[model samples]
Target: MPRSQAATIRESLSAQIDSGLLPLGSKLPSERELSELFSTTRITIKDALLALEAEGRIYREDRRGWFVSPPRLIYNPQYRSHFHDMVTRQQRQVETRVLSASTVLATPALSQELSLGPLAQLLQIRRTRSIDGRVVMYVEHHLKPEFFPGILQQDLSQSLTLIYQQRYDIRYGRSRFDIFPSAARGEVAQALTLAEGSPILLVFRINYDQHGRIIDCDHEYWRHDAIRITVDSHVAAGE
Candidate 1:
């Protein structure tokens, strides 16, 4: 199938960025100039810009025109069932900075969420997630070390789901997610390279096991402009 004119324009611009022809934060040509250069209508150029914006590659300024945006944070909670999996699935370049990992006594809130015993020790892992070399989100996860023996030795930059599936034969059952607008805290701000109290999206997720045991709990804070979440629902035939 033939690609649309807008798609072609988007591809051309994307190639420039990828090849370092269009450096980060550089302003793109004006809509009229792009239209003339591509031999397309200005409307087509606008559509291309919108597509790039959706992908987090560019943004519009009031009077300064369009400019390359910082890298976008990709979150695909739908498949492979882990942050690293979702990121790699999009073929996006990324880096994970492990902020802290240690065995700690579960707090009251953590114990209740994970259904842990009062004195249970949880393996807490915290990381800063980056996309295309830009910090984008802060993540904190808790797991039962007893269930994931030798987990500390594994490379976490890869999918956690892969590790459990390959090493322990553990598969994710169902998950519950809650999202809300929030203000970034001190450490979260530093990790995400944003100012303290910056607007962000806070996500809380609970992953359960086949036997209904809660296996993991995660808290993620994402930059407001770098992430998006989509949900879809369908009615049953009987309904």
Candidate 2:
């Protein structure tokens, strides 16, 4: 009986969301409020909410209530575009919050990937990105410090692609990419406001400079439902 009630509640809320009654990024009624309104228990309300979450209709934050999910951002890996420009073209607000930036030594795996020595210094930058005011991606980038001088002094929140081009006269060239689903944990989970073991889509990028030398690598962790990866056959110029 409770499951049926939960289903009915989930359907009702989903319809509200689809009809724009709840609106994207808008918070839903508190569980207590929902329970009282539906004459049901909090557990029943939670079941409905979880169902809605699983369907990607809504999402919750730690201690924060649920909110309507925005439309999934369409991402085409074949298109060589900056994050800011891409989000702007989609007509959604985008924000990049720099969590930390510092110089660090490259790990063995990274050294092998970038063809650098074990002790090579790298510029490590960590950021959390938001779409429509909802945090969705946590990215960690490791750049060869020698490639761009004075980059650490520049604004880290802006598009690093632009920074690489305009500041250092560097343009992206051929790249290798990898994508897979990963379990959100630790810092990535905390940045995206997801539970420790929540599912996330992980994207790895190995970028090169116009001169054919490796420049940087990025580790992108996205909320599973926040983006849709669609890559057509059209080869991008730099790819």
Candidate 3:
């Protein structure tokens, strides 16, 4: 049995990355260049690149070519700390951009989920988050307007949790999370600089105050390779 060309190329690139020859965030060579260098077809180069991407060693930014990936951020949905604090603690740069805001009429399902009035309108905020200069997460937030007056006038690039606490004296007491694998599409794909149908991680979360009243909900879409989820449980298995 002979080693496939794609496998050889994949291993060669991986070794370079491991040795720091291809440093983190360094863009990989064009497919044509790789094919010429490897004495292989462009399709073979594509195969190897895709394999490396799946392994989290490399990632492609749409129209920008592929690049070595940064260290994956550890994510704990159950952790109460806000994202800005967490990133600062880890010594990594994180940036949040508030893309847009609008009000939308809540349907019966959304009204029930967030306990809004029958005719209530929810304020929707769209944001994108970047880690170490690479855009990695796109979030859509829905909030009740009555909870935070003048919220839109604040510097929205800051953490929402911090804003809620400082301005409204509200805190995130309880959270419900639903995590799942998803595919990047439409606005999320554009925000992430990823091609449509790229693998993604979606987190749907609802936050409530101490008294069980809904505060807000978020739809977070993360680059599949950008996060490593960790959950610490107090109870042992099969308790």
Candidate 4:
């Protein structure tokens, strides 16, 4: 399939960032300005920005406008299974500001996604993910607390995947993912330093284990300009 217009805009902006045409902390052109430059509508520009935000490439500041974000460590979902694992493997300085972490009754959506029965308790972890001191992504994860005893006691700044590996010996297996462009929610805007309705990428991931048991469900909001996901497929020799 051909890439969408938003995807094209995303690539153009990303190229600028990669080539240092737009340096970290440099303010991006205003929506009106970008629309004029791209010869498209402001709405298109908005969509493009949201895509960049979800990739953790650019951040918006209240009244100050959008600025280029620091580079994010590339994370290959096909190979890496954990956020902290991928970041640490890249040797990038990473930190998580725990926005909220507590046990909560699972909502219907959470229950359905985690494949839990009604009334199941869920451990909710909300974090603002930062790299090199810049906020780039906001994540909310739902996990069954019963499966991960004493999880709340561990240092959340470390890799949650590693924690599982050491504590429970559970490893991530195959997963399904869906990605799309979205506008920032109110809290997401605040966390990513973006305006309400700023552009971002929404990633919904469902992870499983060796036995095909659901492990966790993750909702990741990335700065649109900061990352790109590449998928390659080929048929087997026999096929």
Candidate 5:
């Protein structure tokens, strides 16, 4: 038997995207236009588009039509590189928007994580980072206020590492990172424009000084398909 109309349309569109005829990041035609072009019903067109989206060949944005999925950015966990530098090095544009910044009382969890006293004041910073006009990461950073006095007055959108070195003469000595696959829920899901329970990468990080003092802590949530992490291994001659 011949394939269904929806399947045929899906395969045709998939071929166009694969051949670069559609081009990555290019918006697909409207559903109405597609239905007419294929001489099919709207139901068939909708099924075709949904199938493409589920296969990761395309994505939908609010108020925008479907677009071809872009390639993921390559990331190396061992590199202590800033987000701006790493993205631009790959020839991609990156934008950091400081969502909010304020001083808040440290809750028990925040206090223990940052090695601060209970009820101590901490600087809370939230930011959203996007690449090529696609939002890929949401971050929350907490810092002990005493370490960098008047830090709230500085532009928090700049590199935090630079601020630590220039303003406080502090340097990153060692760090701890915890990364895991998790489901995006609540605000994290909304920020990434995904439905609740979408798969995402959750990261917890702590930066420390030479004396083992905690400099800052961070919570980052990333789009699952937007990052490709790499790790390298080398053997010692003596071993």
Candidate 6:
């Protein structure tokens, strides 16, 4: 059977993308332009583009046209590297946007995790992280306000490791990380451009000061397809 107009458009675009004619991170032509080029209706052009998006070959940004999907980032858990440094090392551009910053009373669970006294206040920073212009992770960080005075007043989009060293002469020390597979839901899913209940990676980390004091706790929700985690293992005596 002959292919429909939309299917033909889809196949042509897919072929271009597969053949590297449409490079990664490159934006597709506007809907009107595509419609004219394909000599098809706007609805047909949209259907073709949507089919490409559904295949993970392209993605859309708010107010921005669809772009070719970039490759996934590689994360090495055993390395103690800053987010910006690690991402740059992988040759991918990474950007962080602070979604919300506020001071709130610590919940019982949070209080215990941070070992805070009664009625402790925590500075909460929520952020959306994008790799190669595609939002891939949503993070929430809870910090004890007493350690870093006026932290909320400073720019939170920059690397926190640099901020700690420059402002307070403090550096990150030993840390604990708990990573697991979980469903992305609610705001996290929305931030990563995925549907609710989509499979995602959940990471919980507690950062400590050089003196072994708990500095902050972070919860990160990641699009599973956007990252591959690897950890190096050492050989044991008996192995």
**Tens digit of lDDT per residue, candidate 6, span 96-208?**
99999999999998899889999999999999998887788999999888888998999999988788889998888777889998886788877877766656789898889
Q: What is the C-alpha lDDT of each candidate?
A: 0.78, 0.88, 0.90, 0.80, 0.83, 0.84
How do the predictions measure up, each by TM-score? 0.67, 0.86, 0.91, 0.73, 0.78, 0.71
Off by over 4 Å in 2: 1-5, 38-41, 235-239
* Selected candidate, larger TM-score, 1 vs 2: 2
User: Model 5 over residues 1-239: C-alpha lDDT tens digits?
Assistant: 99988999999999998899999989999999999999989999999987887666777655567788888888765556576888999999998888889998878987887777656988999988899999988998998877889887889888887888889998877678899988778878777787667567888888887677887888999876688887564522222
Summarize candidate 2's per-residue lDDT along 28-108 as a digit string, tens digits.
889999999999999999999988877777888777878888899999765577889998999999999999999998999
Where in model 3 is the C-alpha error above 4 Å?
1-3, 107-109, 117-119, 235-239
Task: Please report how far candidate 3 places residue 150 from its true position, in Å.
Answer: 2.4
- Candidate 5 deviant stretches above 4 angstroms: 1-13, 30-56, 235-239
Q: Highest TM-score: give the candidate number.
A: 3
Off by over 4 Å in 4: 1-22, 28-59, 69-73, 88-91, 234-239
Write the residue-wise lDDT of candidate 1 on 95-202 in tens digits: 888777778888999888888888889988898887877677789989988789878777876667788889988888878888898877788877765545656789
Per-residue alpha-carbon lDDT of candidate 3 for residues 1-239, written as tens digits (9 for 90 to 100): 99998999999999999999999889999999999999989999999999998888999988989999989999878777799888878889999999998888987977888987779998888999999888999999999998987888888899999899899999888799899998999999999999988888999999998777888999999998888988777631222
Top lDDT hit: 3
| Lowest-sum lDDT 10-residue window in model 1 | 230-239
Worst 10 residues of 2 by lDDT: 230-239
Give the Å error, residue 71, model 2: 2.0
lDDT of 1: 0.78
Ranking of predictions according to lDDT:
3, 2, 6, 5, 4, 1
- Worst lDDT 10-window in candidate 6: 230-239
